[model samples]
Target: MKFSRQILSSSFSLDKVPGWTCPWCDKSAVSGKKDDFRIIESVQSKSQHSHPEWEPFRITGTFCGTLICSDENCGEQVVVSGLMEVEERGWCDEGEYFSSYEEILTPLFFVPAIKLFNIGNNIPIAIKDAILETFSAFWQDLSTAGNKIRKVCELIMNDKKIVKTYIDKNGKRKEYSLHTRIDFFGKLKKGEREQKAYGLLMAIKWIGNSSSHVNNSLTKADIINGLEMLHHILELLYDKDYMRIYKLGREYNKKKGPLKHPLFGTRHL
Candidate 1:
């Protein structure tokens, strides 16, 4: 297992999405505070199939209960629990998706009541810039690696069997590329899969590229649509994990947080 300091962006908060409520505390949920948790364990095991190895990570952290309200009687408490593992096949050079299990807002929580003057800037400019900048950076960074990224996606789309090779009676050795995608999605043909994969992979590539390379020409509407389409594709492949990570992000402004896992408890952190 390995460890790293992956900063969970503050832009994501559980309370902002739907179905996230602190039952124990019985209050409208608060957003996950920035840098509130830590990853404790990570282990990778190569599958016998051709696909890249699978890396599983375990994380734990505490959520500070300060932003929801400032009651003199309410002592600041913390929420400690295990986190979800954000995984990536090879997208980040690290070959694993970075996860804090939960994303907490970073810059800090805001209290509208305390603002003596409204500068018309609802949120902090630096934080807003950071979110946009980081997202655009991902888009820009992947452009140079676009071909490689697409190839990986294609590999996942193809139908092939995982085979191990050994030399004949003579003492020779052999190696070959085998298909690992089958284990994830069984017996599917390439043509049947390519369009689906293309939709998913290309959406990601285009959206990321436009954000990075197109200046600010991308309107919020465009961004939303592109993201929704990408999310739909990711859902087909990754199902809940993919949608939870991507779609849950934009809903932070909603009245309620994203949906919750039956056993994972409230996602307020």
Candidate 2:
């Protein structure tokens, strides 16, 4: 995943550039002006070469093109470079030829394919940095991104405290702190109020452990899936109960005051 340029969401007009996704806006828009695009004619030409099966034939050479976005708000610029080869089914109307030149587009380091989902704007500043860093690593290296996700998992555990209590066989009461992802999920009994989605939590732990091992080569899909799970964890833990819809629901259920609402929808603004 090593690229020549370190393309970022802010470096280019996110929505205007094709093959690019903004990790901030979460919207996808791709369009360019045809009039502003042109081929670099200086570096292109036809050459004659001899092949094993053919006596002699002319082949099209390399050429570069430029595309300028015209979406006044996102007028980004980019260059499309590639080489052309003779195609068997192509033709020239003037000459009786059954072949044509087809240009193969080269690498587009700044295209929209690299776009990532925005983690949203309502999260804590610290967690926001961690989320963005995870994505930033994702674009460069999958393994590195997994490690970043691990960091975010650790941060979540540290920022929130969960208590586990039990009555001992001897009739004594005991309480312990849940300090890790596994611990946080392990402390709860089946169907307990504090229990989170087990599968998602376990996957987070698995991702962290795998990323810590030096021999693992993580995949982009794996990192992204893990990141999405973490996103769910955050949303359920801290991002809910504050939206206007949730607020209205809470007001409508006034009888179920703050403590009685499972979704913490009993609180008022």
TM-score, one value per model? 0.25, 0.49
TM-score of candidate 2 relative to the true fold: 0.49
Clashes of each: 12, 9
> Ten consecutive residues with minimal summed lDDT in candidate 1?
1-10
Each model's RMSD to truth, in Å?
Answer: 22.9, 10.3
Name the candidate that leads on lDDT: 2
How far is 41's C-alpha from truth in model 2 (Å)?
17
